[model samples]
Target: MTTVESKTTSAEATKLTVPSRPGFRIGRLSLVRRPFKVLVNLVLLAALLMLVCINIGRGDFPLSIGHVIDVLLGGGTRIERFIVMDLRLPRSPTGVLVGMALGMSGAVTQSISRNSLASPDILGITAGASAAAVALIVLGGGSAFAGVLATLGLPLAALIGGIATAAIIYALAWKRGVQGFRLILVGIAVNAMLTASIGWLLISADINDVSRAQLWLNGSLNGADWGSVWPVMSAVLIVGGLTVVSSFTLGALRLGDDNARSLGVRLQLRQAALLLAAVALAAIATAAAGPVGFVALAAPQIALRLVRTPGPPIIASAILGGLLVVGSDLIARTILPVELPVGIVTSALGGPFLLYLLVRSNRKASA
Candidate 1:
C-alpha cells in the first residue's frame, strides 16, 4: 500500500513552529495559517454567514438580512421575531453543528484508515444510529424523541447505537490489531445488515408512524429550536476542542501504524480514543439531524485540498462542514415551492463527489 508521508506542503505551517515547553510536552492549537488557508477559511465563513442570513428568511414570508439581524438583536415585530429567533435560529445552528460534527469525524476516520473514502456514513456509524432510532420509534413502542429517550433524547440512543456498532465492527475486524482495510470491509457488512433492518422496520411500521420515522430518516430540521442547539453546541465545543488537540496524532497515524508506533505513540489507546471520539461526533450529528448524508464524506478531503496539508485539517474541515450544511439547507429551503430536507441536497451533491473519488482512486491504483 502506498502511504501518505506525514510531510506538510504548506510553507507557512513549516515556518511557524512553536518550541516545546519544559516538564511535559504540551500540544499547541495546531492551526494552519497559510495565505491560501486563510483566504479559504474567510471565503467559507462569509459564505456560511450569507447562507444563515438567507435561510432566516426562507419561509413563505421572507425577511431581509437586516431584519433577521434586527430580530437576533431583540428588536423586531412579533412575526419577525417568531420567524428569525423561534423558527429559523435553531435550524441554522443545527445544520452547522451537524456539518461540523460529521466533517471532523470524517477527517479522523479517513486519517486513521488512510482511505479517502472512509467516512461515518460509509463505515456504518450513521447507519447504526439510524437503525437504533428507527427501532426505538417502530419496535420498542417508544418515540424517538420522547418516552425512553426523553432524558438524554434520541442523541443518546444514537450515541449508544453508533458506538456499539463501531465496537462490533472493530471487534470483527480485529486480528491482533485493527487494519484499515479490514475495518472498512467489516463496516461495509455491518452497514448492509443494519440498512436492511431499517428498511424492514420502515416497511412493517404502522401507517401513522411511517411519516414520523421517514422524516427523521430523511434528516430534516423542520422544528429545530434552542432545545436542539445547546446539546449539539456543547458536543462541538468539548469534542471539537479535543479533536483539535489530538489532530497531530491523526497526522502521525496517517504515516502508517508501524511508523506511528515506532515513534512511541500509544497506538492502541489513541486509536480507541480517536474511534470513540469520531463515533460520538457522528452520533451527535445523527441524533440531532437524523443522518444527513455526505458532509462527513466530503469535508475533510475538501479541507485538505484547500489547506494543502497531508493529513486532515481539523479546523478547516469543521468550518467547511458548517458552511456545507448551512449552505445546503439554504438551497433545500428555497430551491422549490416546498422545502426539501437538507439531507436530500447534500446527497445530491455528495453522491456525485463520492463516485468521482472512487473512480479516481481506482484509476490511480490501476496506474
Candidate 2:
C-alpha cells in the first residue's frame, strides 16, 4: 500500500479505538462529569428512600421521613416503632432484593438469548414457581413446611423448571444450533401452557382457597418479613455478583453466537453458566415475591434506555430493578384504600411496556 493510504488506514483505526465517554450528551449541552454516575446513583438512592418513606407514611398511622429515620435509628415512639420498624421496613427490603434479582436475571436472559423480549416471566420460569406454590397453597397444605416450600422450595423448583424450560426450548430451537427467534417462540409457547395450567389449578380450588391462591399468584409483599427476605437476598446477591463480572463476555455475545464462538467465547459453556445464573436469580426473586413480573422485563429496558448502550448492562439493570420493585411495592401499599398486590401492580405497569417492546421488536425484525 502507498504511504498516504497506510497513514489514512492507521488514522481510521485510531478513531475506531477511541472509547465513548458516558454522560448526558445533547446539542450544546455536553456536560461531562465523573460525578455523573455518583449523581445517578444518588438519584436512585433518593428515589428508593422516597418510596420507602411513602410506603411508611401511608396507612392508618403514617410516619414522616424524619420519624421513619428515627425509628430505623432506634429513637421513635412505640407506635412509630411498630409501624415503621416492625411493619414497613421488612417489606421494603424484600422489594429491593426481589427487584434487583429480577432485573439482573432479566438482563442475563436477554443477553444469552440475544433477544429483548426475553424475561423470567416470558420463559415460563415465574409460571413454574407460581404453579408449584399454588399447588401447595390449594392443596390445603398449611404448615412451616408448606411455607418453606412456597417461599424457598418454589425457587428451587423454579430453578429446575427454568433450566428444564430453557433446555426444552433450546432443544426445539436447535436447527444444527440454537436460533434466538426459535428459542423465543418455543419459550412463549411453553409459557402459555404453564400459565394455563396455573389458571386451571386456581379454578379447581374452593372459593376461600381460590382467594388465598389468587393473592399469592398475584405476587404480594403484603405480609413479607425479613425472615423471607434474607434467604432469597443471599441467593440473588451471589448469583448477581458473579454474573456482573461475566458481563464483558455477555456483551461480546451480542455480536451473534457464531461471531462470539469464532472469537473463542466457548459459546456452550458461557451460555449454560449464564442460563443457570439467570434461572437462579429469577427463582429467588419469584420465591420471595410471588412471581413479581415486569421488573425483570421493565428494569433492564429502562436501564438500557437510560445508559444508551447495548448488551446486558446487568449492574445498571439490577440497580434500576431494585428501584422499580421497591417503588412499585410502595405504590401498591399506598395508592388506594386497600393495599394492592405487588405482582398485580407490576403487571399493570409492565404488561403495556411488554406489548410496546413486542411491537418494536417485531418492527425491527421485519425491517
Best by lDDT: 1
Collision pairs in model 2: none
Q: Which regions in candidate 2 have their CA more than 4 angstroms from the true location?
A: 1-39, 140-154, 206-208
How accurate locally, in lDDT, is each candidate? 0.85, 0.78
Task: Residues 1-367, candidate 2: write the lDDT tens digits.
Answer: 6999999999999998875665577786554454555566567767777776777677778777887888888998888888787877888888888888999989988887888888888877777767766766675456564555566454565565566666776677778666677777887888898889878878877788889878877888887898878877787668888997787679878899888988889987888788778888887777677888888888888888876667657877888888888777777777656778888888898989999998998898899
**Cα TM-score per model:** 0.87, 0.85
Candidate 1: lDDT over CA atoms?
Answer: 0.85
Candidate 2 lDDT trough over 10 residues, lowest sum:
29-38
Candidate 1 stretches greater than 4 Å from native:
1-35, 140-152
Instruction: Give the clash count for each candidate.
Output: 0, 0
Q: Which digits, one per residue and each the tens of the lDDT, describe model 1 over residues 111-164?
A: 888999999999999999888778777755355443554455577888888999
